[model samples]
Each structure stands twice: as C-alpha cells, then as structure tokens.
Target chain A: MLERVDKAKKQIHNTVDALGRSVNIMEVCGTHTVAIFRSGIRSALPESVKLLSGPGCPVCVTDQGYIDTVMDLAAREDCLIATYGDMIRVPGKNGSLETMNRSNVHVVLSSDDAVQLACAHPDKTVVFVAVGFETTTPATAVAVMTAEKMDLSNFCILSAHKLVVPAMQALLSDTKNKIDAFLCPGHVSVIIGSDAYRPVVEQFSRPCVVAGFEPVQVMEGIAEICRQLADESPQVKSLYSAVVTAQGNTRAWELIEAYFEPYDGPWRGLGCIPNGTLRLKRQYKRFDALVRFGIEEIPKEEPNGCLCGQVLCGLINPPQCGLFDAVCTPDTPVGPCMVSSEGACSAWYKYGRRGKVHHD
Target chain B: MCLAVPARIVELMDDRGVADAMGNRWSVRTTLLPDVQVGDIVLIHAGFAIATVDEEEARKTWELFAEIAEFQERQAPSSKEEGTV
Candidate 1:
C-alpha cells in the first residue's frame, strides 16, 4: 500500500519535472475538494502541480434563482419545505431557508425522510428541495416512487439537479480556461458510468480520471492523469474501478430516467450550460414543486463584491473576494460557497488554504 | 453532499434493510441494488444502497489505514480465507 502511494507521488513528480511547466489539474467534485484538503495532499504534491477546484459543489453551483425559489416556497403557509442540511444556510435573493424564520422548513438527512415527513403531515404540501448531482439523484427517484406507491397527495420535488458532464464541458469550452486534465467525481461516475466522460475526453482533448475519496485513490487518479500528460495521450480512465464500472449502475440510471429529463438551465457561476439542470419529466410534472407553486427560475445576479462566481471558475481564491472573511463568514455566509460544508469557500475558510474546490 | 460509505447489511426486510456502516446502523433502501442480500457489503448513499462494494477493493482501503479495519474485518474475519473473500 505504501509502495503504491510512493509510486504515485514519484510518477506525479517525474511528469512535472519532465514537462518543466505548471500542470493545472482540476478536480470536478466537492467531495474531492474536501478530501484533498483534509488529507493534506496539496502540500504533499509538487509545487508546480496546481490543483484547481471546478464547479462541483451542488449547493455552490445551485443557481441563485433556485435558492430564491426555495426560499419563496419556505415562506408559504400551504407548503412545508424539506431539504438537505446544506441548503438551509445557502443565501438566496431575499433570505436563506435558515434565516427565513419559518416553522414549516425541515432539514432532512435522507430523501426518504422527506417522503416520511410528507406522509405524516397530510394537510400541508411537502416540497422537498432536491439539489445534487447523479450520485444523490437516485435517492430522490426512490422517494418519488415511494410517494406514488403510497398514493401521497401532498408531495413534490423542486429539482436543482445538474449534470457533471455538461458543467465540465462548459469549463473547457471557455477560451480563458487552462485546465490540463480532470479528476472526475467518483460517486457521480458510479451512477453516470465512466463511459459518460468519453465525450469530454475526446472532444476537449483532456484526460479524465475517475477517483475515489480516499487519499491514496485521489493521488492515484492524479498520477494517472500525470502519466497521460507525460505520454501526450489523454484518455478517460477510472482508478476506482472496483465500484465504478464502464456502464455504471444501469438500474440507478433507469430510475433517474424514469422521472427526470435534462434541460439547459442557468448554473450559479457558469451560465446556462447545455443540458445542465435535470427537471421532472413531462409525465412526472405533477410531482414538480415548481409547477405546483407556479415558480419560475429567473437567473439572479450575484451580490456586489462577491467573487464566488470567479472562485468557482478557479480564477481566484476565496480570500481574493472582498467579503470573504470580513463580511462572508460561514456563520453569516454571503454566498452558497461559504454556506455548504463541502463548498470551496467553506473548505478554504475552515482550512485557510489556497488553490482547491469541485463536483458531485 | 455526495458522501457515501461501504456498509454491511445486517438485515434485509422486504424492500428496505438495516445496514451497519462502521458501527452506525440505519435503514437503507435496496431498490437500486435489488440483488443485494443481508450479508452483502454495499455503498449506502442518501438512504439507498447504490452499489455492491467489492471486498477486495474495500480491503485495500483498510490496509492503508488500519483504523477502518472494523468495517473490513466484519465481512472477512479470518485471514486464511482472504483469497476466497
């Protein structure tokens, strides 16, 4: 095991030395951002290999419009807002779900809990703010199925689910982007499959390596990318192959396809990506909270002096933002980045480091 | 928010099961992985068993960090049957 770690480190260093240039590797998963920082992998790696955090954090990339919509729903008397703990603190246009001071809002751990909450309270409409990538979408599918099977009347989902592939493509499509390779989100790939990355790898000419959350796994993924760069033959590969198969979880995907359809919607930082947001399918529109509440997702501008948009693009660190620690503390977050526990600003604020953030 | 961990299924009831993730036990839906059984080790993500964890791949993780052997050893207790496991 130690040999494997040493081998990965040596390979990474060799690639950097041979290139004689700084390698910009982006990890497109929020979990990876936290894992890399928590494991101290940033300091362990070569100074030339700058790890850039991409727009992977679901809460952070959740368009301001969606946050505003969720907050609007939270204020309603007829609806009860059920959401993951992270979304409670995220800042919308008016006020956050936590700060709204509403008794109807409930922070649930699992999607199942949202369903259970709906069943328990039959009078109020239980609107679950479903926001996440492919990894967490299946649970929402299951919850929806559960609601349908039980014939629950007061249940619907406000899906802010976005595709990781489209977000990655959007990053590379930009002329100013300088990312060399990608450390793909491991868990999202578990559902979307490794083959899903084939388009980005082939089209963008960047190597994409699927990685696990472990320190060794993350390092191994970086090493694989480094090896690809050294050879000048970039390809899509998976270091975490034990669970992430070529086809991924077909049944899980089937579940997602059964209910949701992809749409090109506005992301917080990156504008409207091609097929970014996943909304409820036509047949399943009855269960869509947006449709039920007559809410429209009008993209809102980020607050003045907030650099969250730039931070998500890997353009600047959190400290570069004027409101970073001074105005935007985690306790009183100005942006979703500082609000989400896995967000880049929260990671930077907590760890006090430079150059890190990512996807699912 | 995509944080998931490998958990050993202690009991399988109809569609849902009670799985133990490093001593933390909770009810998980087996709707995703219908083939999952009571003894199967699965990745518990957002109250659903998303994938069946390959014990070999999981053991490698614990080998690097001994603190997590509790989750690994439960599936493969005896070192003699490591190959079969």
Candidate 2:
C-alpha cells in the first residue's frame, strides 16, 4: 500500500513539475478537507500544487436566516426542535440553539432519532432540522417516509438540503475564485454517482475526480487530476469506484424525487442559488415545517468581520481570518465554519493548524 | 458533513436493519438500497445504507498496490531487506 502511495506521490510531483505552473485544486467536501489535513498531504505536496476548501459543509453553508428561523421555531410553546449535534453551536440572529437556554431543542444523532422523538411526543409539533448534501438526503427521506407509515402527523422537517453540483457551478461562475480542478465528495458521488459531475466538467472545462477519504485514495485522485491537466483534457473520473456506480442508488433518487423538489435557497457565504435548494413536494406539504408553522423568510445578517464567507469560497484559508483563533475558537465560534466538526475552520482548529503557515 | 463508513449488516427486518462497524452497531435503514441483505458490507451514512461495497473492486485496488510493490522489488533486487522499498 505504501509503495503505491509512493508511486502516486512521484507521479504527482512529476506532473506538477511538467506543467511548470500553479495548479489550484479545490476539494468540495468538509470530510476531504479534514482527511487532507489529517494525513499531512499538504506538507508533502509540491509548492506548485495548492488545495483549497470549498462550500461543502452543510452546517457552515446554512444561511443565517435559516438558523434564525430554527431558533424561532424552537421558541414556540408547542414546537420541539431536533437537529444534529453540529448545529447546536451555530449562531443565528440573536443566539445559537445552545445559548438560547431553550429546553425544546434536542440534539439528535440521526434523522430516525428525530422521528422516534416525534413519535414519543404525540402532542407537540416536532421539527427535524434537516441539513446535508445528497449523502444525507436519503436518511431524511426515509425518516419522512417512516413518519408517514406511522401516521405521525405531528412530525415535520425544516430542510436545508443543498445540491452539490449547483454549488460547484456557482463557484466556477465566480471569476474571483480560480479553481483549476475539483476533488468531488466521495459519499455524495456514491448517491449522485460519478456521471453527475460530467455536466460540470463539460460546462466549465475543469477536471473533477471523485475521491475517498483515505489518504491513498485522495492522493490517487489528485494524481488523476494532475494527469488530466498535463494532457489538457478535463474529464470526470471516479477513483472510489468500489462503492460508487454510474447511476448511483436508483431507490435513493426515486425517494428524493417523490418527496422534494428543487427551489432557490440561500447559502451563508454565497447568496441564493437558483434550484440549489430542496423543499418538500406538494403531496408531502404536511411534512414541510416551513409551511406548517407559517415561518416567513427573515433577512440575513452577515457576521461582523467573520471571513467564513471568504473561507468557504476558497478565497482564503481559516488562518487568514483575524478572528479565527482569537474569538472564533471551537468553544465560542463566531461563524458556522467553526461550529460544525466537518467545517474547514473547525477542522483546522482541532487539528492544530492555527499557528502553522498555510500553502494557500 | 458527508462522513460515511463501511459497516456489515448483521440483521435485516424489512427496510430497517442493524449494521455493525468496529464493535459498534447502528440501526440503519436499507430503503436506499432495498436489495441489500444480511452479512453484506455496505457504505452507511446518517443511519442509512447508501451503497454496498464491491468486494471485488476493493480486492482489485489492493492487487494493483501489490503489483506496484512487486515491480519495485524486481527493480531493486540487491536491496532485498524490504524496509526501504
């Protein structure tokens, strides 16, 4: 295994040297960001090749308005909020769910746990704060289906599910961020498949390689991207083919299509992206929490001096932010990037990257 | 937060099943991959089986790695200590 990794490393260096120019590769997944840092891949890489973090963390990309809306729902007398642990510390307009001192909000591990919580509390309206990429959409879909099977009318979901491909498109269209290639999220590809990235590559003319979280797999993916760049051919390749297929899980696609439809949604750093959001279908309107509670969209207020927006766009690293370590530590995060474990800032903080110089 | 891991399905009951990974078990839903069965290794995310791991492909990847190691060994026959390679 180490021998193959050595070969891949050599190939990467040779390819980068052959290009004789700076190559910017953006890994659009928080997990990949953590893996790259954890494996010390950056230090091993040549100076010409750079890796940047993109808008992949669901908690980090969740708009402030959505967080405020969740806080509003939690404040209701008859409403109970169930969400993943990472969201508890993300600040809304007034405060976070943890600092709100509200007993109605509960941290859940899985969407099914939220369903079970709803089932237990038959009188109170339970709203599951669903947020993730395609990897987690199926779990939310299954939870909604389970709620329907058990006739749990009190249960509903406040979905902040964002599509990956649209966000990639948004990044490519922005002239400020020059991403030469992409290291696509492996788990998202497992559900959406490698073929889903073909459109992005075709339109933007950038190489996209689906990679696993392991160090070798990540190196191999980077090597493949470098190889494509050397040949001046931009294409979509899947190095994590052990699990990902061309069509992906057909049943997952069916379930997602059945319950949700594409809508324009807001991202924290990036503004409203057209058809980048997912909302419950008309038939499943009862399970939609936004409609059930009649919650209006609140105006978003960006955090003061927090460069998480810039960090998420691959324009800057976490250390580049003034408040990154001083005020935005994991314990007291001023931005969503420091709140979520998968977030780039949080990973950098936890993995001891504060004082070190970044390649970017 | 797309962090998924490989887990083996220990039990299957309709669309819901129990998947065990490294001594910890989770109640995972198999609705995404309805064709999955017991004892199958699946890639699970957020308490759901997203896809089944192809053992053959996994083996092939490992075999490629082994082939690379063998080629390196053939090139450096004098240094047969196996620590440097």
Q: Where in model 2 is the C-alpha error above 4 Å?
A: A352-359, B54-85
Docking class of 2: acceptable
Candidate 2 displacement at residue A93 in angstroms: 2.5
At residue A346, what lDDT does model 1 achieve? 77
- In order, candidate lDDTs are 0.83, 0.84
Local accuracy of candidate 1 as per-residue lDDT tens digits, A187-265: 8999999999999988999999999988889989999998899899999899888789999999999999998899998
lDDT of 2 by residue, B1-85 (tens): 5777677899999988998865779788888887899999887777888888866654443454455448546543442210100
Inter-residue clash pairs, candidate 1: A28-A359, A29-A358, A29-A359, A30-A358, A30-A359, A53-A357, A56-A358, A56-A359
- At residue A159, candidate 2 shows an lDDT of 93
**Top DockQ model:** 1
What is the C-alpha RMSD, rounded to one decimal, of candidate 1? 6.6
Candidate 1, residue B75: how far the Cα is off, in Å:
32
Model 2 B-chain TM: 0.63
